[model samples]
Target: MEIRNPIPPFSLETALEKVQLAEDAWNSQDPIRVSLAYTIDTEWRNRSEFINGRENVVKFLSSKWQRELNYKLKKELWAFTGNRIAVRFEYEFHDIQGQWFRAYGNENWEFDDNGLMRRRFACINDLAIKEQERHIV
Candidate 1:
């Protein structure tokens, strides 16, 4: 029964805070740390993959970071309502061979009363970029 603080019925300030916190967590590239922000049975649609439960989330993120090296992410608050939020985000990452990419996406999230995200839907597109073209700053 962990309450993730800044729970539900989000105001503009709270919504922004939530989005910033999420961005920080993802940028950390720690699957276990990020998974804790979601509920035990959290559901997610990341790119074309559909994942359910926190365990799956951790596995998915672990696999992702392993493949996508030097990951950096930025998330912006798009909209919000009671227990729900929408975000637009961009992230930069490279592969083991150092092929760089920038990914742009949107996510819709629904949180439980405890403020742990129970559902997340994301749509993303990745663009190949030269290593010099990338500015993850």
Candidate 2:
């Protein structure tokens, strides 16, 4: 649980590790586990909603995955500096009606010295697609 610390000044390998770690955590779709990677006082702007603190993060993600059934995600590191990292990501999921979609997004993350994300801003767009169009396996 205490992984990916020593916040920032990342090498390419560490940056990739960070991104993959995030991707894997999210794909698990466990809100509580994902919230642990963030600071207790984390601030987040997820799409149109404003979220503050780990409790809100857990609430938001639980609601998200509940609606985004069979969610799968992939993320790539776009850039990194001192304690900030930028990422681009894609995810596929379906609604309760069984309509599939793919979502594209970018996130800017700032980490605390302990490697917990202190701030996150994300912009995302969803595109409806057929099941055959899904690329994530």
Candidate 3:
């Protein structure tokens, strides 16, 4: 079944702006700032687990940083239609044992009328290897 987006075509530019704001928030690594992009009751499915609420989002992100040291992420806009957007990104981080990992993923987002994300779904695959194995510059 084809899912119809509630937002009109003209509003896609604003959606793109929101996507940029979220990207900036993630790059900052401040969970508080990133959490603002989502609604207080936002829902997310990251891989297999389900996450709900802004506070839980922040907690999950904080825990992620504790494990993924030196975490850096870069997101690229792939496609968008009104309040929905698709992004492709790569993130690099090292664990406590100093083993580095580069994860590649794509996320699909849905936002409310106020440009706050109401739902998000992400699919990620990781290659856990030494730092020297990376080829992308």
37-83: candidate 3 lDDT, tens digit per residue: 78889999987879999999999888888898878787877888766
Name the better of 1 and 3 by lDDT. Answer: 1
Q: Which residue pairs of candidate 3 clash?
A: none
For candidate 1, the 10 contiguous residues with the lowest summed lDDT are 128-137
Query: Candidate 3 — which residues are off by over 4 angstroms?
Result: 1-16, 134-137
Q: Specify the poorest-scoring 10-residue window by lDDT in model 3.
A: 1-10
- In candidate 1, list every pair of residues with a backbone clash: none
**Order of candidate numbers by lDDT, starting with the best:** 1, 2, 3
* Model 1 agreement with the true structure over 36-131: per-residue lDDT tens digits: 999999999998899999999999999999999999998989999999999999999999998999999999999999899999999999999998
**Every model's Cα RMSD, please?**
0.7, 1.6, 5.4
Write one digit per residue (lDDT tens) for candidate 2, span 1-137.
45445457777887788888899899999999899999988999999999999999999999999999999999999999888899999999999999999999999999987788999999999999999999997
Which portions of model 2 miss their true places by more than 4 Å?
1-6
As for TM-score, the candidate ahead, 2 or 3, is 2
Residue 80, model 3: lDDT of 83
Clashes of 1: 0
The list of candidate 1 runs beyond 4 A from truth reads none
Of candidates 2 and 1, the better by TM-score: 1
